[model samples]
Target: MAWVALIIAGLVETVYAAALERSATFTRLWPTLVFLAGVSVSMLGLAIAVRTIPIGTAYAVWVGIGAVGTAIYGIAVLDEPATAARLGCLLLIIAGVAGLKLLH
Candidate 1:
């Protein structure tokens, strides 16, 4: 359950990051609201998960998932860079996430 919460938090963080990237003007009220809501939820979920998971491991996994997921979403939907080098970095992020999970 903690793992599930942690993963969801990470994914939500990714979504929030993407939303924030397009929210420079602050005129898009809905996306901005969604982003704020997502951030609040993600932090709450991480706080709950931290009760059981090691702080270092949980933080690493959270950041790894957010970075990789946001990058992938950017490339696929926003047509951001999906070059081989970028993909390699994504793979490395996955490896780090997996390493942290294996500690469980």
Candidate 2:
């Protein structure tokens, strides 16, 4: 389904972000490869999902998912700060993403 594709794409976006950071400006080998693959799959999924989902809604959801997911990745694995404010903002984004889905 389009929704499934979209969710996969969104999750892939998180992988893409993490791999990119690990790529070290593309100087690395495996991480750069992973980044490339993640981006390709993510884009394909987004393109497929757009066929059935409204572009505006789909885009917002995709970005929201990516943002929240990547932030969590950064906090959990990358030793980034997990301040209360940052966590709160992530929850807000999650709420907005859920609202968009529920309204759809």
Best by TM-score: 2
lDDT of each: 0.90, 0.94
Residue-wise C-alpha lDDT for candidate 2, range 1-104, written one tens digit per residue: 99999999999999999999999999999999999999999999999999998988898889899999999999899899999999999999999988988988
RMSD of 2: 0.7
Q: TM-score for each prediction?
A: 0.94, 0.96
Model 2, global lDDT: 0.94
Which pairs clash in model 2? none
Model 2 — TM-score against the truth? 0.96
Local error of candidate 1 at 102, Å?
A: 0.3
User: How many pairs of residues in model 2 come into backbone collision?
Assistant: 0
